[model samples]
Target: MYEKVINASYDPIFIADKDGYGIKMNEAYTRVTGITEDQLIGRHLKDVVKDGIISESVSLKVLKEKKQVTIIQHVNGKELLVTGNPIFDDKGNVSHIVTNLRNISALKSLEAELSRTKELANKYLQEIKIYQKKEDMISHEGVIANSRQMLNVINLVQKITPFNSTVLLLGESGVGKEVIANLIQKWSTRSNKPFIKVNCAAIPKELIESELFGYEKGAFTGADSRGRPGLFEQAHTGTIFLDEIGEMPLQLQGKLLRVLQEFEVTRIGGRRTIKIDVRVISATNKDLESLVKRGEFREDLYYRLNIIPIKIPPLRKRQEDIPLLANYFLDQANQKYHLNKQLTDDALLAMKAYAWPGNVREMQNLIERLVITTEADDITASHLPFSNQTAFVPQPIQKKMKEVLQDIEREMILKAISEYKTTRKAAEVLGISQSALVKKMQRLGI
Candidate 1:
């Protein structure tokens, strides 16, 4: 019955005598080792090892050690997990050694595949996180500004909100001219009214008039049979933001000037004149003065648009704001990508020192790129693409040591006040009396 049970088992099993000689083996053992049972039974394990039928004998180790042993064994060109357990007699002597063998090639292959799958899953998860962060940052609302120049611009915007004066925003491309336009619309009394935006540069010269003024039916070939209201008429009783106004065609400029002066529009192939009450907010990156001088732009239109000119300073002129902007952008990126990343002191210094010709938009894009590509939680100078680029290095300004010390002291006092909130607490933090701290703050204009 024992022999029948052993023979019926799926795992390979072999039993050895006290002297390490094979006494009996199951049919599975013979099948696994590719050896006949007649040849295996009653044969010494050392003899099987010497004959190269099995690589090593765990049974022999168990017999010598008088304990259980497990090892990897190579037999008949297959890998196996072989375990040998000793059976003890009354005298604590190893009476027999029973060994079991299990094939391990399939398990090893499965382990490797699982490892590869985990690596791929981790890679894809990181990519998805970055994409999510980008969406979140891009969807953030409001203008990000803290510089004095920008503050003045904001003040000017606020001052003009009560009236319907035509505002002309002037700045280099990507300096957020559109953002100012939107702010104007939001602050105006007509905030609930529709604020239409039109890019003069993007529209064709032939379609400019029709796009700006409502066209009558059959006004021209391929005109919509039902007729169409132009952007100006559509923005009636609201605001119309015309971006890149310098790109307006010479002839269209005359018509636009007329509409601005008369507050009326004449549709193509139509006799009826339409009166409209729409606020015009024009923006341009080009110099309208240059265009006027070159006869490319109407001088009358330039004067009308320049009534309330607001020039947005480039990012380089507002270097003190870089730290604030950088941290803001970093926070946005972190919220977007579901990650916590910070800029190193050196990284911030490097950013502030560099000239941003592409302006605020460039800084925003760079911050996003660094957040995504950098592996470290803290973004160091090495992670910046422009860190090694040849850039403008400012000449050091000569200053007295006492003056520099005063600057450092003022900065420390401001920092302590911000952190502690109360003058007494700030004084304790700075190791000074509250009265003295107040005196210094007054002198430093803190």
Candidate 2:
């Protein structure tokens, strides 16, 4: 029954005589250590350790000390916590030593994972503090402007904020035109008043007229029961930001032109004209002059909105601000997603080299995605979705044909790996075996 209990125990059990010769071992001992009863039962503990079968013998230690002994042991590449207890005979002499072996590999693995998680949490906290300090210094009302062009734009905004002139913000779609509009409103006398923003492109042509100019209660089907005021009425004592003015339909352009000229708007089905005391701010990425020449836009209305045009340069043109903006966006993403991600120097270099067609908006989205998807804390050049190798790293003036070929090969492999996001898929795309691709990557230092 004692043998049955010992064999039934989940933990491995080993028993040896007081002389340190193994006397008995359970089935669990054989399963855990991969050592059969024949191999260890007749063998001495000292011999087992000498033969490199186990790291140490807790039973031997217990025998020497005449007391219980606990130790960490390694057997068959597994970590174990082993405890040995000595049994004394009636004569007060040690008679037997019994040991219990508990595998601690899973616990060790869990401990390592927890340690990594803690380290990442601490890193994220530190990153947040650093960025918060920098944000306080460099940001102006949530706008990051370090480049000369952007600084000049901000200066221009400050100059024009006191005036009620119609300001036209011209830039690429993601160039923060709306931010400039917000700045104007924030610094203007109408800061306390309502600021109505209408995206002309987002609204449908059929409803835009009613939406912008307001309509009577029964103006059309699906109309609001109570008479609703338009965006211009909503901004009677404030400012109105019209985004994507270029996409405003031509038919509605005449009414918009009249509103700009008279500061009065007649509702879609209302006879009375309401005068609005509001400042107008319009922004567009399209070339209004070209649109005017094409008759797609009204030339007269164009001049009205262009009274104080502020052209925001694209992101590629203002490369100096990339680092600041990148860090700012990274900080935001970390805060939002609870991630600890940082960009490497090479990653920053790659960003500066690439032509940001989508401008600041792309960088913001990409940073958020990296913060969420990246496994490592440091986001390196390899982690970037797009890499411009020739622009990022200056090539040597003179190179051998073999070196040139190697450069092309390296570029191709890097591009494939970055695009596919895995060695096996990249290898398949490159028409090479996974092992060959790995070997090539190693040689190229990829």
Best by the TM-score measure: 2
Q: 386 in model 1: Cα distance from truth in Å?
A: 1.6
Number of residue pairs clashing in candidate 2, backbone atoms closer than 3 angstroms, sequence gap of 3 or more or interchain? 0
Question: Candidate 1: which stretches are off by over 4 Å?
Answer: 1-141, 393-446
* lDDT of candidates 1 onward, in order: 0.84, 0.88
TM-score of each: 0.56, 0.58
Deviation from native of the Cα of residue 297 in model 1, angstroms: 1.2
Candidate 2 clashing pairs?
none
- For model 2 the TM-score comes to 0.58
Whole-model lDDT, model 1: 0.84
Model 2 is weakest, by summed lDDT over 10 consecutive residues, at 390-399
lDDT of 2: 0.88
**Lowest summed lDDT window (length 10), candidate 1:** 390-399
